[model samples]
Target: MMIPIRKEQRQENMHLKKTPMTKDMKKGMIEDMKKLKRYSTVIKSYSYMKAFRLLATSLLVALSMGFTSCGEDELDRMPSTSLDEGTLFDKTDKLFSEYIKDYSNIKCRYGLQGESSVLLSGLKDNHLWFSEYDAVSKQLKSEWIDIEKTDTIQQLYKGYGEYETLYVKYVAPLYYKEISTGNIVTFNIGGRFQTIFTSNHKAKRTQLQYDNSKNGIAHNWYKESVFIADCCYSHEGDTIYIAKSRPSFDENGNLAGVTLVSYEEGIELSGRYINRRSFKEGKSVWSTYIAPPFDVPSDAKRNYTLLGNTTNIWEYKCEVTFYDGTKRDFTFKINIDNGKIVTDEIKVTGISINENTVNLKQGETFQLTATVQPDNATNNKVIWSSSNETVASISQEGLVTANSAGETNITVTTEDGNFSTTAIVTVTSNEDEDKATLARLEGTWDMLKCYGWEYNDQNIKENWEENVVGEYIFFEDEDGNGGYNDGYKTYYFASSVEGNKLILRNSEWLDGKTSIIITKLTETELHLKAIDSVSEENYEMKRR
Candidate 1:
C-alpha cells in the first residue's frame, strides 16, 4: 500500500519489531561480559604462577648442586639417608624387647613346613627389619610408625604367623652379651629351649619327618625364642650357635649395609635341655618331664632316675641306649618352693594274668605271670591271692597250688593302682574215681556229732565239741546233689567228688564253695573233715 521506500529503512524497522530489547535483559548481558573478562584475567595469572614455580624449583636444584660440589670432605659430612649399624642394632633390640618379656619362658618347635626354616633363620638374625642399609631411617622418623605402611618391616613382622601371638603371651629377654670384632658387633641373647615333643612321646626321627598336610596330624608344642649371636653361648643346659655377616662400611668409616647369615647348625634343640619346668604360687609344687633334646632312633631305650630329696629341689637323670650300641645321658634340675617338690610319677593303669582259666590235678603247681598295662609303670609289683585257699592256694609270686579237687579264683592285684585280674582254676581227679566216690554217698544219714581236736604234747586233746544226736539230717542223691537239714529247715547245695574230697557249692556259703576231705566213707558210715578249717571239725554220720 506504500510507495517504493528505502531498503535500509525497511530492514531496520523489521529488526526493531522482531526483537524488542528490555532494560533487565540489557543489564544481564552487561553482567555476563564482566564475568567473562574476570575469568580471562584468572587464566593469565595461573599461567604466570606456574612459570614462577618452575623457576623456583630450578634455582633450588642449582643451589643443592653447588653445595654438594663444595669439597670431598664437605660431601662426606652431609647427613646420611641410611641408618648406622649401631642405630639399626638399637632398633632391632627394641623390637625384640617388645616381643620377649621373660627369657626363661621362651621355647620353640620346628621341623614341618620348609617355611619354618626360613622363619628360624630370620628369627636368629634378631628379627632384623632390613637386610641391607638404605634410606629406611628417613621413613622411620615417626615415633609410632604403622607397620602396614612399611612393606619390608611388615613382611618381617607377619612372617612369624601364629608365633607372633605366642610371643605376646609367653616371652621375655633374659640377658645379652656383646662381642666386638673390628667393625662388627655381635649380640648374644640367652633364653630357655624346648623340643618339638615332650617326654611322653619323645622326639623321634620318623615323627619329625611327618608331613602335616599328608597326615593331618596336629601337634601341640611350646613356643620358643630364636637365639641371636655370632658365637656359641651356653646357659643352663642350652647351647645356641648364631652367626652373621659383618656389616659393610664406606671409606669414611660409616656403615653402608649389612647381611644376615644362616646359623652353622639346624634350629633343633640338641643334647640336654629343660622340657617342662613350672611352679605353683603359694603351693610349693614343682613338676617336670625330661627327655633327649634331639630326635633319637625308635629302638632306643630310656631309663630315668629321680635324685635329690623330695622335700627340696630335685634332679632327674635320663640314660639312653641306642640300637647302634651308642649311649647318651642327660640330666635336669627341678626347683620347688619352700623346699617341697611334687612330681608326677607313672602309675599302673591295668593288669592282666597270663591264664584266664586253668585246669590242674590236686597237688599240682603252676606259675602264673601278671603283665601291667605299661611296662614303665612306677610300681608294677602285684599281690596274688586265692578266693578259696581250702581248694587252691596262690603265693606272692603268682604261684598256684591245687590243694584239693575244687574250683577257686586266683587273683593278681597291682600295688600301685590296685588294678586286678582273676583266673578260674579247676582241679580234677581221675574220672572213674570221681564217679565211684559220688555213687558211694547217695542216701540220707542220721543226726551227727562234730568235734575239733588238737595235739597236746603228742596227746590227742579235744578242744571243742557239738552234739547233734537228732537235730540234723544229711542226705545225698545219685547226681551228687546234697544238703543238711537241722530239723526245722532244709538247705540245698550242688556237689562234686574228686579223689577223697567232696565239694559243696551254694550261694549261701561264705566262700561260694565248701571243701571237705572224705576221711572215711562206706555204705553204713561217713566221716568228714573240713579242709583248712580253723577249728579242724570232724563230722560223723550214719546212714539211715
Candidate 2:
C-alpha cells in the first residue's frame, strides 16, 4: 500500500522559500516521510507541489521507491491501515501506563523477594525437615533435608520411577540432606557449617558496611550456634538452651567444637550455648527444629576478635549490623591493625631539654631538643618560648637566637598537660673589643664555603663562588694594604674581634662597622653567621 505525502510540503513551497536542500536535508526528509506513513491516512490527498518537493528533497527516497517496485517484499511496505489521531494517541497513552505499572510492580516485588523467600522456606535453611512418631510401635523417626546432602534425599529422587532420572538431572541434584538420631542430639553445634549456624565469637551480629578496623568480617555472615538437643523422653519437660559460642574447652584453653581450632589462630570461635526450649512436643511428633535466626547485637563491638601479625600486612574480618537491620561481613587489609589491644600512655608526666645551659655570642643561634618521657606519652606536643624576647628569640621548632648581650630562659611546655623544661641562655657581645682576639683576627682569610640556615636546619650546598670572587679578608692593625686583590678590583677593611663578634669597618663600601658573630674560631678555620633581608646565611672561611 502506498501512502501519499502530506500537503505541508506544497504549502511550504507556496511560501516561495527558495532554500536549496542538501544531501543531509534530503536524508532527514526521507526519515520524516517514513514516520508520517504510520498515520498517513490522516493526510487527505496529495498535492502537485508536494510530489515536486519530494523529488527535490532527496534522491534516496526516490531510490527506495524503485527498490519497492523491483524486489522488496510486502513486509517492507507501509501498512494501508490507519487510525484517527485521537484513537492513536489514546492507544499510546494506555501502553505507557501499562509499561509504568509493570516497571513499578517489578521493583516492589524485587524488594520483597529476600524476605519472602526466607519465610516461605519454613525451615530458615532453604530446606525442609520433618519428624513423625508411631504411637503403636513406640518409635520415633526424624529426617533432615538440606540442599547439599545427596546420599539421603538425593536417593529419594534417584530412579523412584521413570521420572527419577529426569528428577536427578533437573531437580534432585539441586538439594542436600543430612540425618541425625539419638535421645540427646545436636545439629551444627560448633558452627562448622557456618550458613546453618548464625553466630560468631566476635559478636552475635555482623556489619553490612565497613568503616573502621574493629568489627568487620569481609564478605561473610556472622554464624554461631550452641543449642540443647535432647532425645530422651525423661527430659521432655526440661528447657533447651542455645548459645552463640562453643560449650566445651580444648587443651589450649580455646573453645572445643566441630573443628580442632582455637583463638591462637587470631580469630576466636569459642562460645557457650544459651537458648532454651521445651521438649514436650517431641513425644507426639518427632520434631526437627532449625536453629532460630540469630539476633544481631545492636551495641556489639566489631573488634572483638583480631588475628594476624600487625607488623606486616594482614587480613582482618568482622561483621557489622547496619542501622536498617541488615548485616554484612567486611574484610580489610591494613598495616596497623587497630583491632589488637595496644597499651599507649594516656598522659604525659615529664619533659626535659637536651641542653640545660648554653653560652652564645650576639646573633648566634642554637637548636634545642626537648624529650618527652615514657616515649608513648599521649601528647608530646610542646610550646617553645623565650623568657626575654629582646635578649633571645625562640622559634616554634626550638631554635634559640641571641639578639643582644643578656641572659634569658628558653622554656618548652607540653601541650598535652602541665609539664615543662627550661634552659639557661647567656649571650654576651662587647663589639669584639678584646686585644688578644683582635690580634688573632689579624690575618688574610679566604672564604671556602657558604651555608643557608632555617629554623633548625642548615644546608651547605650553596655555591659561594657564583656570588663573589676573591672573597678574602685582611685584618691588619690600621694598614689595609694587605687586603685581597682580584683582576677587577682590590678591596681592604679594618677588622677587630670585639668580644665574640667580628667587627669589619670596610673603607670601600660601608661608612659604619659591620659586626658578625664568630660562631666557630680556630687556628685554621673561621665560621661567621650573618642575617639578610630574607634569611640567615653562614659562611666558613679558611685562614691563609
Candidate 3:
C-alpha cells in the first residue's frame, strides 16, 4: 500500500506542467470512484467521456466567437453542435467518470496508489475552485522549488515537518478537540484565532495501531511536503495550523527534536514542541508534548505550584497527562517585563549550604556541601567561590581551607537559576603570627620579572633575562602545595620555608632542588632571590 516514489524523479517531475487539482478534489474523486461497483465499465467509458468534455469546451468557445460577429437575430438561434448548461449538468455521471480519469492520471504521476495515496490525499480537504486551488498550488510549488535549491531552507522544511507531524498526529488531538463536545474553545484574540482545552476534558489513554510497512513511505513523502498553503484547519475542523519555523539543531548538525518558536499574525510567542518516538510490535509510534500558550484557559485545571520567584520572574511547576497515560512535569517561567510565559524542563528552585557558620584554626580544612532543591533539576551544577581568599580559600569542589585569623563568606551558586547560598567561615590562629605570611601567599600571583645569570662551561656568568609577567602561580595552602601555569601547561610542586629561604622541590623542574631567598613579603608584594650552583636569579611578583 506504500508508494515508492524516488526523490530524484519527483524533483525532476515537479517542474512539469500538469492538471492542477487540490488534495480535496483528489479525495472527493477517489471516494466517488470507490462508490461505483462497476469500475471496469467506468474505465471503458473514460475515453469517450474525456473526448466529449473536450468537444463541449471547444464548441462553447467557438460559439462565443461566432456570436461576437452575428446579428441580434442570429444570437437567438441555438447552435447544432453546442450543448447548454442544463444538458451538460444532466450527464453528471459522465462528468464524474471523466474526473475519475483525471484522478487516476494524478495518481500515476505522483505514485499515489494505496495507503500512501490515501494518506497524501487526506492531508487538506478544503473546498476550493480550480482557479483558486491552482493559484495556491503554484505558490506552494514555487516555495518548494526554492527550498530545494537552498540547503538551509531544505533542512528547515525537513526539520519543521518532522516536528509538525508529531504535533498533528498526537499532541494537537489531545489539546484541540471538537467545539461541540466542549473539549476545546476558540477566542478571537488580537484578530487571531487561539484555541485552548476545557478544564474537565483531560486526555484519556488510547491504544493506537499503525501499519509499519507504511512508515518509510509516509515519513519521506511528508518530510518535504506541506499540505496547506496558508493558515488553515484540518479536515476534521478541530486543529489549526498558524505558523512554522525550523527546529533547533546542535553544533554537530543533529536535530534538537523540538520547535522553539511559533507566530500568530506577526506576534511572536515562544513555545516548545518535543517529539518522542517509541516502538510497538515493530511499528513506529510518535508522541509529542507542547507548552501551554500565553493565554491559558480560565476554566482549565489549576494544578500549578509556585516553585520560586524573583523581582520580575516567577517559576511554577505543573504536571500534565498525555493521551498515552504518561505524565510529564513542566516548569513555567513568567516574565513580568513583557507579560510573556515560557516553559522549560525542570529547573533549580533554591539552594542550601550545609554549614551556616564555621570556626576553624589556621591550616585547618573542612568540606562544605551544597544541596540543590528538587533533586531532579535540569542543571544542578554549582560554582564555588570565596569572598575573601586571604581569610579562607575554597576549592571548586567546596573544600574550604582556613588561612589566617579572619572571616570570609564561602558561597555556592546554582548554574541554571543563579540561586546562591553562603556560609561564613572564621579562622583563629594558634601558631606564630609569622605564619600569617604563608596566608598572604595562599592566593594567585602574577610574575612581574625574572632576571639572572647562568654560568657557561667556561665558568663565565652570562646575562639571561626573561619577561614572565603574564605567567601565573597559585599557592593552595600553608603546606606549600602550589601550581604554576605559563599559558600552556601547569606544573605542580611542593615547597617549604626555612628562615628567609623558600625551597621548592619538583621532579619536573630543571633541578630537583631550588632555593629562593624571600627578600620581601607583604600583603601585596613578593620579591625573591633564587640561588643555584651556577647563577642567581631575582624574581618579583604581585598578589592577584
User: What are the C-alpha RMSDs, in order, of all predicted structures?
Assistant: 30.9, 29.8, 22.6
- Evaluate residue 250 in candidate 2 and report its C-alpha lDDT on the 0 to 100 scale: 33
* Candidate 1 wrong stretches, greater than 4 Å: 1-190, 193-441, 445-449, 453-474, 478-526, 529-537, 542-544
Error of 1 at 437 (Å): 8.1
> Ranking by TM-score, best first?
2, 1, 3
Clashing pairs counted in every model: 9, 50, 0
Candidate 3's displacement at residue 400, Å, is 41
- How does each model score on TM-score? 0.22, 0.24, 0.21
| Candidate 3 wrongly placed segments (more than 4 Å) | 1-434, 507-510
For candidate 3, lDDT tens digit of each residue in 301-381?
434555765333556666655555555566766543333454465778999989999998888999999999979665567
User: In candidate 2, how many Å is residue 209 off?
Assistant: 41
Instruction: Sum up the clashes in candidate 3.
Output: 0
**lDDT per residue (tens digit) for residues 1-544 in model 1:** 1111124334433433233324563353334323222221111101111221111222212211110000011111111222223222223223323333321111111100111111000122122111111122312111110111111111111232421211200111111111121011111011111112111222211111112222111111112222322122222113343234322223322223211112221111123332222111111122223445667776778765656433224566778888888889876544433222235556789998889999988778999999998986655678899999988999998899988888999999987778999999998756746887888888787757878765566566548887867654444666777777766667777878878887777724323224678899888998888744333667888888
* Candidate 3: Cα lDDT at 264: 19
- Alpha-carbon local distance difference test for all models: 0.41, 0.39, 0.43
Query: Lowest-scoring 10 consecutive residues by lDDT in candidate 1?
Result: 111-120
Ranking by lDDT: 3, 1, 2
